[model samples]
Target: MTGLLVKNYGIKKAAKLSGVSEYTLRAWERRYSIIIPFRSESNRRLYSEYDINKLKLLRKLTERGIQISNLSSLSINDLKGLLNRVDSEIISTDEKYLQLYDIASVDKTINDSLEAIKNFNEKKLLLILHRAYKKSNFLEFVENVLFPVMVKIGYQWKSGLLRIAHEHFTSAVIVKFVLKISSEFEIKNKAPKIVITSPDGQHHDFGAIIGDSLAASEGWKSTYLGVSLSAEDIATAVNQTNSHCIFLSIIYPNDNPRMEAQLLELSKSIHDDVVIIAGGNAVTGYKDILTNINAHIVKTPKHFRDTLKSIRNQIRIDKRENYEKKYL
Candidate 1:
């Protein structure tokens, strides 16, 4: 069988098409031995169309639960066999998955929440959260119910079904609940000083608040510097708080070159010892920017927790070294 020949695409174009950074693409090639493209006469990598298509297929399959390591060893024929197995598994479990679909199909509950928010019905919103909090694991309920409902509210706000004021009201209520939960957890050690802020022109901050709350709950002393903070303001907060880490919640992509430039500048201005971490929707398509800024992009709640744990260990080591230098 003849392998499909590919036309080489430049790194930038390939990154845009694959929704993966050129750095990440290069890393995958070097680390995983996947998609080895030929070099051009100018010493640029020329990825074939065939290679691009395969990458797209690979991304899709992996997202659907096909382990990349397993797929990496498979020949084209073997991949087809594996895909068939995946399809069969998906079909076999279709009934179990249908519960999610069914929940999504129920528009009335979502609509009611939107209406209640639009009408400023705080009682209804509080009742909803209160009931969910009591009936389910607080964190699970937040992840499953409140998060989905918030997404719906956002959609409605975007579509003009709900107003910005209404959304703010809903958000304020949720923030209170998150803080309530945070209050329950005790700080173990001198909380590692951390500062949380939103990037400039990005005002959605529920995620930041939640992150700060979780960090605090896990024994990190975090200063929540609400929304619309410029890069300079963030630096100021970092200095004022004597923070070791700065976490920014970005909720949308800033296609503006100025914003990108600010992020780069911000990265350079911060102390080398400080870890800059970014999370939320705004940072989704801009992971490369984070890399450029010497920052880490965290994609999920689990990642956030793990990062805090790692930072805590580093702090412990630093404290021990400082004590030894002073006494021994």
Candidate 2:
């Protein structure tokens, strides 16, 4: 489908619209020919509306782990087609790969957990996860087995291969583990206190627990205020905790028409000093709204950690500068 016809946009506007840096855009054009921009007489680069949409789609697909090098030559329709297919590398239902793959021993851990879920044995599932945690580092378990297992479980549920009870059981066990681990390793004096929770209508809360765990691991005092909270309640919790950042976790079927309104209200109610972020499966649907309201969207635990660290570093810099100005 053709995007809207608009005036030719310069490189800066194109990068902002496409969510690609100007340097990256130039690099992609030179190396991959992803979206070649038109050049003016003075050598300024210009992009059309169609080019902008294509670049945005490329960014989204690349974020999902598709290599831009492989996708650069394809049309937008081809990219969409590939995305529509089940990502075989990720949430594939292929029995051969699911039951037999032995890379890093992570596949076995994931398959074992899935089997325990199938048998409706919560204890067994938790045992497998605990064993995996014992065998691998926290980040390894999170990135390799835990996160992939959740994605596979969701895919199975939506495909009618599993029931809601299975998802609930797994979520309950995982959240318990996340909280226990976070508590075990928390630094009492950690700065940039972070508050995580699901806003009203979002029944899933595992994402919040995961955020709390990661934030704690990064030496942040992370507090999880359970799920299904109204805007006023969330704001109250943040205010009470004197949180430096608030993370809103959203789950699938995020058909909450009131979500944007709720976010806007919460943003307005909270102190401007606090940073707001949204994450989880349903975050894509609210990206535009989040950006409009000055809220950040993080897609992975690593991304979340990096964002917090950047903020913490900036705070440190500001404090050092203030101290120097006062005394040195």
Candidate 3:
């Protein structure tokens, strides 16, 4: 009666329950001789509930790079003992697996936004849009798909398929999302600082917030001054913070000339060691304006990553040289 409680599950059902592919399950059973299942009278492999639970644990361990050969020698009791010992240390690994499921479910909400935007359904659209924007790595989701969806929603609103209230609601949701994400990452050290901010008249600060988050994630000491700071204020912030880099975001192309002039003035006011990095749609048509200034121009998030890596490397090299001179 106790054994009967462990109902036999077929391979497909085991795969579904354990979140491992059927091919991988077969490989584990055949190649590694792990989790040998019972055979039915018809000679088909059938896994009991106990065996399925064991397989789930095995899959979790294997994903974390525990050698399969080592696992093959362990009995069910032995595996359970190992899991009991290591489970606390491996919580983050387990969380990653759970996050995969959460990410897939959140992505469905994004897909719903696409459909709602296509149908011009403001109510459904706003709900789904808010859900997707709250997901972890939402900035990537926004840059890749949600941005285009927003453009479509805007076009629909202009053509009268959607109301102005719908557009305002969506923008407010996005602003909150940006704020939430930026606040999640904090400056933890006193490394050479980078101050990122929006230029004068530039109310849009999402790009700057995203850049700050990226910097924080990469362990950069960055001060985000948020939106609507004048060029003089930004230069003063840099001087006061002793920041090595000033990243100015220009979200609209029409503001490039003014932004360029402001940045030029700021660069002149700052010390020669400080670097100015200009980016976003505002620099789209005015690449030439950046030529006279000592600045690095980054156009996208990927470019920003590469540029940040270079800056960090240079900082390291400079520090190493200084250390050699002082200690050696």
Candidate lDDT values, in order: 0.69, 0.76, 0.66
Listed per candidate, the RMSD to the true structure in angstroms reads 9.9, 8.5, 21.9
CA displacement after TM-score superposition, residue 258 of candidate 1 (Å): 2.0
Best-to-worst ranking by lDDT:
2, 1, 3
lDDT over C-alpha atoms for residue 74 of model 3: 83
Stretches off by above 4 angstroms in model 3 are: 1-111, 114-139, 157-160, 253-257
Which pairs in model 1 have colliding backbones?
A: 6-48, 6-49, 7-48, 7-49, 8-46, 8-47, 251-282, 252-282
Which tens-of-lDDT digit does each residue in 1-328 have in candidate 2? 3444443999877765565655568768999988877788998888898888788778656656578898978988887777666243444223322443344246677788889988888889878888888987776677677777877787789999999988888888888877777778858674778888998899877888888888888888877888889999999989998888888888754678999899889987877657787888778777777865656567666767777886676566656766877999
Give the TM-score of each candidate. Answer: 0.62, 0.67, 0.56
Over 1-328, each residue of candidate 1 has an lDDT whose tens digit, in order, gives 1355756588766654553445556756887888787888888987766676566556546645566666776666666666667656653222332343346447455556656777788888777667666766544555556666776666668888778887789899889877887787777556788998887877787989878886876688888889878888898789877788988888765464567877876766666567777877567567667755546566555556767776667667767766877999
- The per-residue C-alpha lDDT of model 2 at residue 242 equals 87
Q: Model 2: which ten-residue window has the lowest total lDDT?
A: 92-101
Backbone clashes under 3 angstroms, per model: 8, 0, 0
What would the TM-score be for candidate 2 when compared with the true structure? 0.67
Ten-residue stretch with the least lDDT total in model 1: 91-100
